[model samples]
Target: MKPLLRVVLVIDALLLLAFGLLFLLTPWTSLYNALQLAQVEPALVGQGFGIALLGLAWLALHASIDGAMTRAVARTVGHVNWLTGVLMLVWLIALRSPSLSAFGQLVGAVVAVVLVLIGLGGVRLAAAVRRREKAQAAGAGATGREQKQAEKAEKQAAQAREAEVYQTEPVTKVSPPVSPATGRRVEPDFTAAHQPGVVTAETRTVETRSTQTHTAADEARDAAADSPGAPRPPFHG
Candidate 1:
């Protein structure tokens, strides 16, 4: 409730409580003379009515203190105030007692107006509270949806990063090189081949084998010429 409205409700409740106490404590004769009533029976009836008003005042005071002047509390207070105001107006019009002085009628009219105004205020407070609650609920729902979307995007991004990391990693396993001379698997000499003016062990072994083959061929040719089945070569000179 607004500060001004709260203040108004507090003041109204206090005033009602004071009037109820006065009617309850004072004698019937005193009340009759104050209101200038012809009947003492009506003063007795006023005491009972005053007690009911005191209860209502207590309810209003409690609602204000607890900050619950909305919804059920507000509606109940509004209905009660409206009923009281309407009844007072009806009594003034229908009864119009000849014993009631001008001052008494004026006081009743003022009280009725106050009750009506308070009733309207209660209704307005309830409506304002309902609208505020609805707006808050809508904002909360929107925030929840945005949070879920953000989490989903984060998960997708993490999965993509993992896939990228897997693709970029180097392969570790490779087949060993085979030696041509022995036809066996051996460790490769990669650095020796890349260096300038350097001969590798595998290349030197291949060169030695080629020179031995040439020597063997020359010896076989000389032996064939010495044999009886060998053919003679034509003279070039």
Candidate 2:
């Protein structure tokens, strides 16, 4: 509850308590002066008023103690106060008697109107408090939902990143080529032997003839050197 409203409720409770005590203790003088009654018993009227005031005091005190818990009670108290004020005004207008003076009736009417206005103020304050609490609860619920959604989104994004990292391809290492004859790194050669449809029968025949000619020339030279009756060649230093 608001501070100003709380203070007003406390003051109202105190006023009701004081008035109840007054009517209960000094029944004769107070009731006679306030109600202007001659025939009716003052004590009986005082007792009724005292009990009603005490009940109102208790309701007001309960509202002051925990406004949230006793909002309905506070509203009930407000309605009762308004009804009491309206009844008093109605009685003053409908039943005018010699016992009560015009000035006194006017004063009563004014006080009744004041009470009605105060009761309406209290009712309005309670309604406003209830609305504020409802709005705050709704806002808190929305905030919690938003927070949960944000956390879920962050979790999903983290999982996606992990999946992306896991799906990456690995690199393959390659070694340098080595020569077979020299046992060292060398450039590869692509020749007719390695190629398809290049080494034909005509090419093989030409290579065979070249090899036979070289071997025949070497044999002729050896036979000539071994012969005996050949022309003698002059020797020079």
Quote each prediction's TM-score: 0.63, 0.60
The list of candidate 1 runs beyond 4 A from truth reads 37-49, 68-71, 95-99, 168-172, 175-237
Clashes of 2: 0
Q: Which residue pairs overlap in candidate 2's backbone?
A: none
In TM-score terms, which candidate is top?
Answer: 1
lDDT of 2 by residue, 1-237 (tens): 655456657666776787677667554665656665333455778778888899889878877778564566556666766787888778777765434777777777886797687677777877877788889999999999999999999999999999888889676766667855489976554866546778867569878998899999999988887789766678897
Against the correct fold, how does model 2 do in TM-score?
A: 0.60
lDDT for position 124 in model 2:
82
- Count of residue pairs whose backbone atoms collide, per candidate: 0, 0
CA displacement after TM-score superposition, residue 129 of candidate 1 (Å): 2.5
